[model samples]
Target: MDGADYLHPGSEWAKEPDDIDSIDFSPTVTIMYFADDDTWQAVWGGREQLGEFEGTREEAIAWARERCNTIRIYSPSEGDIVDLVPDE
Candidate 1:
């Protein structure tokens, strides 16, 4: 606590949040492009390949936005983990 930078597990600085829903939770949806198929897939939870959906990039984005509040589209050029739906 002296340094006032590090947060220990049980330290007072790490108090439990009162509003859990307000937290910026990670996206449970991921849209990936398959070059072999020339289509995009909207994967649920992770890259485990669950809940398949094949479409164009715009169509995939629309599909993801309709079903969930957040989505992660795979960006090869940019950095990983760019949320389609950022926390307000």
Candidate 2:
């Protein structure tokens, strides 16, 4: 199917989707803002998330920095992105 055996079901090549929520993705730290609740989130190692009133952009940046000296801050809404800590 689709000219690809991998795309054919029961071809021993098709597999069921894995549980992504149980899997960790990127291994970097990044901060994201939620304007609706005025909350900032710091995603740590893509494994955990911290969301709290320490939620301002500055606060979020600080929080991220404390845990990881090198982190990335990006704003999709403002089209702004900057790697606050330069790579060494």
Candidate 3:
């Protein structure tokens, strides 16, 4: 896929109260995508973990665009790293 095909949406992820407790915030959105060779993966997550996805790079990008403020594209070899931190 062409790099230009990648699209990112703003404010796709937001800090919201949990369903169990409206006063508590524990929700987030995460999206993961794999490279063309399947050897690499890109994962994107929100402040919590409300939404999550794991698949090809295309799928991850699509998922993030649909449910994340920013899509972090990286290789699976990078390990599980925190791309962003929540603000208090």
Candidate 4:
């Protein structure tokens, strides 16, 4: 396999695949608030338990940035989700 294969599976022999960044999927990081626990949960890879945090969203973002490329904060009260990763 060629070096390009690592980036796009089989681009060396087959058609080059679409960019992974353009693919629409679930977020890599999520900051969720629990009313019962009154704590913020930093979820990684949609399922992996990264651990929990306390205080403002800024703190959570800082914590998540160290581990993930894209981060999302979900507000249960507002019932909305915010994406922290900027557009490329």
Candidate 2 Cα errors over 4 Å, as ranges: 1-27, 46-54, 76-81, 85-88
lDDT of 4 by residue, 2-86 (tens): 2122233322223544775655555477676655556666767643454556666677778888777878666444354556655
Q: Per-residue error at 36 for model 2, in Å?
A: 1.2
Listed per model in order, the count of residue pairs whose N, CA or C atoms clash below 3 Å is 0, 0, 6, 0
Cα error, candidate 4, residue 55 (Å) = 6.7
Order the candidates by lDDT, highest first — what do you get? 1, 4, 2, 3
Model 3: runs farther than 4 Å from truth?
1-45, 75-88
TM-score each candidate.
0.53, 0.47, 0.36, 0.48
Candidate 1: tens digits of C-alpha lDDT, residues 1-88 = 2211223444442467787776655546667666666777776644343465779988888777776776876554542335675531
Clash count (model 2, backbone only): 0
Better of 2 and 3 by TM-score: 2
Q: lDDT (CA) for every model shown?
A: 0.60, 0.54, 0.42, 0.58
Candidate 2 residues 1-88, lDDT tens each? 2212213344322344477575545555666555567766666675555332247778877777667665756554433444666531
Q: lDDT value for candidate 1?
A: 0.60
Which segments of model 4 are wrong by more than 4 Å? 1-27, 46-56, 85-88
Error of 2 at 31 (Å): 0.4
Say which candidate scores most in TM-score.
1
Give the TM-score comparing model 4 with the true structure, all chains together.
Answer: 0.48
lDDT accuracy of residue 76 in candidate 1: 44
lDDT comparing candidate 3 with the true structure = 0.42
| lDDT per residue (tens digit) for residues 1-88 in model 3 | 6322233322222223356453423333333333465532333333444545556656655655666554444324543323433330
Off by over 4 Å in 1: 1-27, 45-50, 79-81, 85-88
